[model samples]
Target: MKLQQQKYRLKLCQPAILPLAVLTALTASPILADETDAEKEKARVIEVIEVTATRQTENLQRVPIAVTALSGAELEQYQIQNLGQLEALVPNLNLHVGDAANAVVYIRGVGQLDSISFNDPGVGIYLDDVYLGRVQGAFLDVVDPQQIEVLRGPQGTLYGRNTIGGAVKFTSARPSETTEGYVSVLAGNYQQRGVKASLTGPLIDEQLAGRFAIAKSSRDGFSFNQYTGKNDYDKDSLTWRGSLLFTPVSEFTAYLVLDGSNQNPDYSRTPHRETPIYSLPSGDFLPVGEDPFVVNANFNDREELRTKGVALTLDYQLQQSTLKSITAYREMNYRTHLDLDGTPDASFGIYSYEDQDQLSQELQWLYRSESLSLVSGLFYFRENSWSLGGAIAPDFFVPLGNGVFFPFPVISAGLRDQTNTSYAVYSNMSWQLSEPLSITLGARWTSEKKQVSNSGEEFFGTGIDTPQGMQAVFGTGIGHSLTGYDASQRWNDFSPRAVLNYQYSSQTMLYSSVSKGFKSGGFNGRLTSFAQPYDPETLWSYEAGAKSLLLNQQLRLNTAFFYNDYKNFQLSRFSIDPDTGAFLSLFENSGKATTYGAELELQALLTDSLTLNMNLGYLNGGYDKLIGDFEQEVSDERELVNAPRWNGRLGLDYWFDLGSRGTLSVNAGASFKSKTYLTVSSSDLLAQPGFTLYDLYVNWQSQDERWQLNLFGKNLTDKRYRQHGFDLSASPGVQLGYYGDPRTYGLQLTYRYF
Candidate 1:
């Protein structure tokens, strides 16, 4: 059956070769027909992108940092809907869905795997300049965005702590004076359906303007569950945003934004890949299959996620400076249930729930002069979060002689509460030293405090179905209520950055920089006993890069090389408690490591109607030392987690004019990644082999620009690959792997109202 499916996919791809060949031929010939010098010059000019990566508005090519900026139009053209879709467009970035509630993100081989409230994300996600405190809510939907900027390497100096990896900023579209709006509808395979709409207009003439956008989408599951006769890994979500811009006077403005999302989807399906023999009470062992999208589970798994946030931004423009203030509040509630064993025997299962809220305030002052630019800010953030849930193994059994067995059901419950607060002050200054040379200096001092309380109980005996049932068999049960522990810790650090930039020519720039990054330490939230707190992790990075525009602005090329000296790398591990014989998750600091890499990005307008773009990345280096209990198991020979040795993307887009009727566009792209390890131990069961994916899109628009249509196909070849994995063979006797989405084709239609 799998072979037949492969053959069918090959038949579907044969039609794409002709169009690709035509595009290639066009790239080698002149695209403009008998045009004057002025017309040709206008056709070759690339759009000038503006970015705020350095805390001030400036041309993207002039920034002394490694950054990738994508405009709203470009995002739409690429069909990017969320943060997970951005990995293919950027170099050295990796993102995937770890579970229903966690979106794992990695940049330049640095990120956090655990999503518990006590642990902070290594990569910072910012929405409209407001930082998201938890990784559980970082998988944001892109709704009416104005721009998205991905800054590579460490951003500790300006973004503050927990940014040792990098930072991603999503800037939403603000209210506009002109009245305009659009509505779009889409349909695809697997019962996929979606609708999106947006509107922007003035409420009080030139004084007040309001904008609103909403998106709702639903799709059938990707995997089939034989036990329940239902589909798994489905999608159902609704997201919306509203904003009001008040310009009381010409010099002052206040913007208030509100956003929310609700996602209720079927549980993620992690099918068994390789399984060890586990005899059931019936004297038979469960059999595992090769199919990745089929599961046999006894539990009806599900997940629910709801989030809301509000932010107010105030800006006051002075003669030579601007003062700004941002106040924001956000909250999230997430719950999920899983059948970890992926078998009908119901050997092991788990449920988790988390509730979190955060409040933040920031003030900034910007000063710009003829030869000098300065930006300074004060930031304060606080968060309160808690989690309550447990695991169950009601059908667990231990065998005796002569085919006899005894029920050994295991039930466990736990609760953890935590509070975090942070304060920081930062400043960045840039001065032009000569006609083509400039220097920049920045620094930030941050202090953070974390407090946590944990309590739990585990029972091992017969007739232990739930936590309440434990009391009935208290005397007979072999378990005890764990002693609760409360702890607090404080840490402070100073991160600094220095850069030198030289404008070699009007369209070329060269830069070199040195920066330091830091991530705070905290107690493990999933502990059965009191343990020492892990120490903080720090890194020093040195980088050099160049940005250039060639062929009279028709081509843009950027390249960078970086080396990092890492210390006290925080690593997560699972081990069995010697006292209680219970499995526990904990963190320990590894000794030292180093990483060096290089990246290249190119965008060229081969002709007036043809464009080509590519991005390539190469990474090397691993741990130089090891420590702790798992040292013998985890060796330095393993590659870094989510860090592929080589990754790249290539794309081509061409436009065709249809006289006065309409215009059509076609785009083709392919992305490839080398092998990657998903776990710190680099287990072979959790490693993803190298793979390549292809995509194609066709678009048409009416000459009046009021109607548009798009037909798109993703993963065109129906390639099979793993997005995430877990090695639970030691406990559950099953290796679980989550597969990526298969081939999907859809059509979208849009109508504009003005």
Candidate 2:
């Protein structure tokens, strides 16, 4: 579909609202004992949920924030294999995978656009309370997780910097006191195969315990490369984790976790079929196959990534409070080779590599009572990273007159060496003023220093050695020599939060809060000359929300309305000069912007065998002030990227007894999103139309819960949609896009032993 004339207008239909109102009404009604057994069964469908949104365990209905929590079973039921699947289950969230190893996660239209090593993500990712340093390795696959929590809006008070767009927390299951183990095998289309296993048992009676888990999955690419006769997006990965727990006494405990992963995958993109406007010297445009999955490429792009990490935690309980300490170390090695031009002519190719290591330590003190609660902590972090890469553009050689020709340069190489050190102190306190009224306050102070050294060489001209027996026709001059420079910077920030909550009844509560979020600034490692550093970005968020449970715990409803004011918003854009053919990118502090949105979550037991879950989100605000280079006023036309006007999901679940042998359950769901722009430039080439996708799952389990089987299908309707897009409309008039998976179906078999 062409995007030049596309329009996206919000549509609020009655069908979506009527069901939510009916669920709310059911929650408010009481269940009478005189009713039939079916009624009793419906009233008993409610399940209690707990979350650690505040760094402490609490009932979900008592938390005063917009959060979505999913258990391991629920994740499996929804076929949440990796982080990319999360967008379909959460509200106002969009996860776009840029490649096999990197992604861009947007919340309320705020997020990072670049995945370079030097820049940090606005949305933070954490595994078992340890922060993941880069998005390149943050696409963690779900492997026997205890729970997953997605917190919306600003969360700097507790999560600190890099959480201006919110945070995602994944908590793995700990060691069990009793022996247990489970294994599963799965097979699907496109030669897909997967196996996962986990075991937990006591090591020294009641004093020690251990747990171990492993997962291996491989699949052929959905798209086929006709030129190479190979799959274009294949994947093979393996991951393993182990944990040990020691309980020396009743008041003290220690836990350690070690994990590692290896991933090898092919490139994840195909060229567009549209013809480029720019004609080559032969007066012919590049030809791309009509099939969406086929591409004409000379290079077989690939990557290999390896990661390792370890975390240790200690806890000691006192008479009135508890003290805890956590230490973690992580390392990663990544390398990639890709065809940058996406053509069969071998116009240009790129090879990039990175090596990094990080360490962090944190200490916490917690005090809790009936009327007062407090949590305070100190954190220290350090990281060292290095990267090197080069782009080869052999097509630079152009023929002059007759048989004479100039062999332009071959490659442009660059490298980055950086070190970062940071420290912070944070505290959160809550006090009850009366039986139904309470107040909470939070503050965090952080300081950071970053040192960087960058060097590069542009081999743009010709070389001395040539078959034509001629001196250097163009380059090989002193100006092309590699040069290096050093840079350093320091930053400090203070974030605070205030909240007022009131308990209206035994089953309902209302809350309002104001908070500040921050993200530290850093150098742009990709730049070769006149490197400009961007300033920090900050946000102020105000929110009001309500949490309630009705119908004797059979129904749940939560809602929140939020508005955010952003200052010095950091925006990154890529530009390919038409005159020089140089690819340049810049990170700058854009003007101020504002956003307002609302979110709703509802879960209800509609009947004895039927349950309903739904989420709806709306956003309307955009950039109120902005400008392009040369001080051109572009405020009225620019908007935030990946921020759709409306997003929603509706799911229905049903279960029935299959005689005395087993039980069968079925799930059907649909998710929809409005049109969105992939970049801040708002170029027509980057626009994507609205789309809706459906999924289905069926499961059968034995009465004793020892054997199980599941059949699942995603994108059941065979809808085609783009997950990401790139703009190249200046003279080529051609745009490139990475597509989401097509229709896929699979079956899984499982067995458990105790």
Candidate 3:
């Protein structure tokens, strides 16, 4: 590690305010830039931010949509490492991590809370222009990114299906014509250490360029298991990306991107601190633990995830339009061993392993002229996935004779294979009817086919604790054999949109739109009997919004109000089967639901030295009607999972000249989230109380902008909060919660080489 070489010179107890003293001393020198240029730059707070929200590059202020754009510099200044922290900066956005491979995302009270292989997220995630087919490995770390864009609302017209909520787009920094890159090192508490380096430059003069970047980070866990004498949430990960840009002709360009990551970590969750409300099946009471970050598991739990992807993009510039093609392939392998009950005596556990592969191709033509602009595209996607898992009982429960214990799984074991193929054709057009007004129309036609194959066995018999019991469950011996199932289904849909935009002036615009979105239906292979495919989910969204820059470009404010009518909403739940009195995974279609919300974003240069940014979101979400399989109506007043009534952030950024030596910048933010439930089947055990988190950072840059030193603290108040929660009442009194990180402070040193 590079830090080892420099460790001797650094003191361990340096004051947190030492950076400020250094900045004060440097301020005695002359200013780096002229006064006029500085004044002009400070006044233009709007800063011509750009985005591809409309499938075309345009200024954010000029785009008639609800969008937020963040630059790489901005993300670094805020010390955001992954998508999970992004919720603090964007309204109505929630990101939860179940493991290194699975990221559950929600936008505007709409999202997929479950990480089931058969289901898809309502919000689409894209890298560059390639859509990610699965949530696995979606919570990728930031790596030399150029920009991140979030479009709030149904983007189905341009992005296709599964975008009823919204979309997130990430664009990486490209290789420059000249040699340029940076190297950074960070050290923090909990044995935290990380290294990130990137190199980009011309490989063949004006025709070709290449870029390569790599990042490695590791951190010790905070949660400790006394019985096992091991930490439960340790992390170790490495990620690398390489890209090449080829320009063989004056009007044509091709780019190839390859990226991969490997992660190994301990268990992701520990037992909840709240006492169990139900009695244990063993007639034992829940253990008492005053510390929130402690558990009593005795099993050996491990997790490993590997992901790789390749993408090729080509663009051709014609006389009147630009044609683009994208081809992508991705694969992931995820494996985990989990202790479900968290007690020293593990009543339940699981070993789950899954392998997935996906491929996609898309071609589009974009044309823009004086009075008309249009985008038309064709997209195709295919995916193959397989899962093998086993549910097991504790070794102590079924001990063998002669100091031995059963080695095989106890309850159930299964293997499942799934495949999906989808195709779509979409077009969006805008026509200028008047000097300051335009009407936009868009539609998408999609067809999809899905297939599922499942085979599994259940061990049942008195004294069935050995390999013979497994054979009996498979019917190879004396027990009843579980029947295997194979099924396929096809679906088609047409989603459409209409928008009206009025350009009040160059600095302001108003827009209103109505759009439709859809998600494909699939089979739930986990079920053992009479498994049926769920119906597709659909939603129609109506929204009105405004974007404006006021006070001589010193203040920017954007707001939007939206309402969605949803039908056949897909929901996943763990429910008790009346006949068996056992919990089972169930996928169902809710009859109807509705969500209405409003969002406000503001960016203002309160003074030349101080800036303010704020985001506020208010959501009202509930079911119009729903009936569970229990022959009873689920209450209509239940709020959506992960949907808080109120969520917002307030940020302050200040920068001052460190004179000729450098510049100093300081930023602080406070984020608040109201109480939220983690699952649609809201339970007292699944609810997360509202909490507030604060972050602070200070950066000092060298005069030439080649060196930067950053001091940062996250969750400064050391608030303990839950990122996710699960109700295992089926096991009688078991509740598990995945916790957010604790107060962490770190310093980073970065040097640019060009």
Number of the top-ranking candidate, with lDDT as the measure: 1
Tens-place lDDT per residue, model 2, 1-754, is 0001001000000112223343344334443224367745644556667898887788888888889998777777776788888898888998866743676888887788776778778888888888887777788888878889999987766753348889889999899999998888888888888898999999999899999999999989888876688888787999999999999898999999999999887654554433442223344456545666666665556677888899999989998798989899999888776554467654545656788898989888888999988878898888899887656666533334343434444566677889988888888899999999999999988898888998776654534222111212222343266666789999999999999999999889999999888888888888856467888889999999999888776678889999999888888766555455455566778788899999999887777557788999998788877766546678788877888899989998765545334555667899999988876678655577899999887666655677666677888888877677655443123456667888887877777777
Clashing pairs in 2: 462-475
Roughly what TM-score does model 2 have, to 2 decimal places? 0.89
lDDT by residue (tens digit), candidate 1, 724-754: 7766543434577778788887777777788
* CA deviation > 4 Å runs, candidate 2: 1-43, 160-162, 266-283, 287-290, 396-410, 459-479, 576-581, 730-734
* Model 3 Cα lDDT, one tens digit per residue, 271-344: 54455432124543555576768877654376788999999999999987999999999998887766666666
lDDT of each: 0.77, 0.75, 0.76
TM-score comparison, 1 vs 2, better candidate: 1
Q: How close is every model to the real structure, measured as TM-score?
A: 0.91, 0.89, 0.92
* Cα-lDDT of candidate 1: 0.77
> Where in model 1 is the C-alpha error above 4 Å?
1-37, 160-162, 277-284, 396-408, 459-479, 577-581, 628-633
What TM-score number comes out for model 1? Answer: 0.91
Clashing pairs in 3: 101-137
Report the number of clashing residue pairs per model. 0, 1, 1
lDDT, candidate 3, at 707: 82
